[model samples]
Target: MPGETVQPTPPGPAPVPVPGTLVVDTSRGDRLGEFRGAAGPYWSLRAVCGGVEWEAEPGAVRRATRKERLHAEIERWNARSRGEVL
Candidate 1:
């Protein structure tokens, strides 16, 4: 292999996080949501209380904190008690 030129490897696609992942979206006032997979160019997220879903840029989201998770759970419980959610 004398005088052979080395070719550069091409970059791969972006890594996407899986579903059921708890995250906080700073673009939405740091609101908490669960990752539900890709939504076009953005990522789809569902509310922790099983409410409406929203789309967000992956860069604007991060893993949610323990405290945030607890609070969201409580909110869901309270909503259930009031029959707001099943």
Candidate 2:
């Protein structure tokens, strides 16, 4: 133990952004905030849905759906809008 070097503990995982809180995107990454317009474009408000807490981007966010049905819907909409039969 006399000559042994005790290495310092490495930093832990970053904190989870709190729900209902805004965060700023610093060069070091996200930090908590109570209001918007104080953060950069890469930053966003934190939220929780379906029992999971996560950061959300601006605008509409929806639950993930099956790919086949999702693609089919898109195709149907495109066809209808183009006046083509589906």
Candidate 3:
């Protein structure tokens, strides 16, 4: 339609993280994941306990804090103990 306004998509954050780096995806309730690599315009990340990878917008993810990292490690350990992961 004429005279209609359009909103451009916002740009995502820069400085992509390296593979195996832990990051929190704020878009997904701050789920922690291990950075896998880039997936076109998005970044790929896998759960700490090891599962299917998920893509997230770069702007929605940030490096995990020390506390978050520790928690993820413990979660992984617990999962392994329960045979949830090998």
Candidate 4:
């Protein structure tokens, strides 16, 4: 123990993105939103520009495509730019 290097604790499985992370729900035309955790039997996602969160099947949701992500970001920027969102 004196000379042996202590092995760092191995991290758990890849972490699930926390709530408010941008994601795309492929089940519904690949709509983009922020991950809002699970809702009963489904996962919940909220629009990037802010809105009522919606329930979606976990299998149907995934990390957003590059294009989709950029689109959502731009939309948010525009909303903020227009003072629609704070």
Candidate 5:
């Protein structure tokens, strides 16, 4: 271990705040959430339907086009239902 280099663990997901546009994730059967800032090292998002909130790691906030975002959101919803968090 003396010569080994330890890399710091990466941070949690951050919200990519897109103001004023309502995003619907049909795959999840629910609407995509709104950005509500960070909670500790995790980024928080508030799903409009039923007011459900969730946090994701920072890697999730990578810049994406509108179409990419929508596709990602749909995939996210599907993943969530399958007990997988992206």
Candidate 6:
């Protein structure tokens, strides 16, 4: 093993979602965010309430369920009301 070479694993294919579509990144604790676009090998997602974007692996991202979408909308509204997001 001393002279053995190692190889890096390629990123897995992720489902592509339209921009502005709500999605859930299960790998990120089910964080709800809006799909921005592809970020190299990862997908770009930002909080529905508006905040810094985070890169999620394609395999970990999926369209938000109806319930999740509603919840995210409600969270956005709550943030807006509290002046935490505009």
Root-mean-square deviation (CA) per prediction = 5.5, 13.7, 7.2, 6.7, 11.2, 8.1
* Candidate 5 deviation (Cα RMSD): 11.2
- Minimum summed lDDT over a 10-residue window in model 6 is located at 9-18
Candidate 1 overall lDDT versus native: 0.85
lDDT, residue 85, candidate 3 = 49
**Model 5, span 1-86: residue lDDT tens:** 89999999986544445543344333344435555666787656665333566665555444335875677568668877988644
Preferred candidate (lDDT higher): 2 or 5:
5
List where candidate 5 sits over 4 angstroms from the true fold: 1-31, 67-86
lDDT of 6 by residue, 1-86 (tens): 89999999997666588899999899989888999999788999988877799998988888889999889888888887888835
3 against 6, candidate with superior TM-score: 3
Candidate 2 clashing pairs, residues 3+ apart or interchain: none
Poorly placed runs, candidate 3 (over 4 Å): 1-12
In model 5, the clashing pairs are 12-57, 12-58, 13-56, 13-57, 13-58, 14-58
Instruction: Using TM-score, give the best candidate's number.
Output: 3
Q: What local distance difference test score does each model get?
A: 0.85, 0.39, 0.92, 0.80, 0.56, 0.87
lDDT of 1 by residue, 1-86 (tens): 99999999985554677788789889999989989999788989998878788999887888888998889889889988989853
Worst 10 residues of 1 by lDDT: 10-19
Write down the TM-score for model 4.
0.72
Q: What is the lDDT of residue 65 in candidate 1?
A: 88
- TM-score per prediction, in order, is 0.70, 0.29, 0.76, 0.72, 0.36, 0.74
Q: Model 2 scores what on Cα lDDT?
A: 0.39
Candidate 1 positional error at 16, Å: 3.2
Question: What order do candidates take by lDDT, descending?
Answer: 3, 6, 1, 4, 5, 2
- Name the better of 2 and 3 by lDDT: 3
Q: At residue 43, give the lDDT of candidate 5.
A: 58
Predicted structure 5: lDDT? 0.56
Error of 2 at 74 (Å): 44
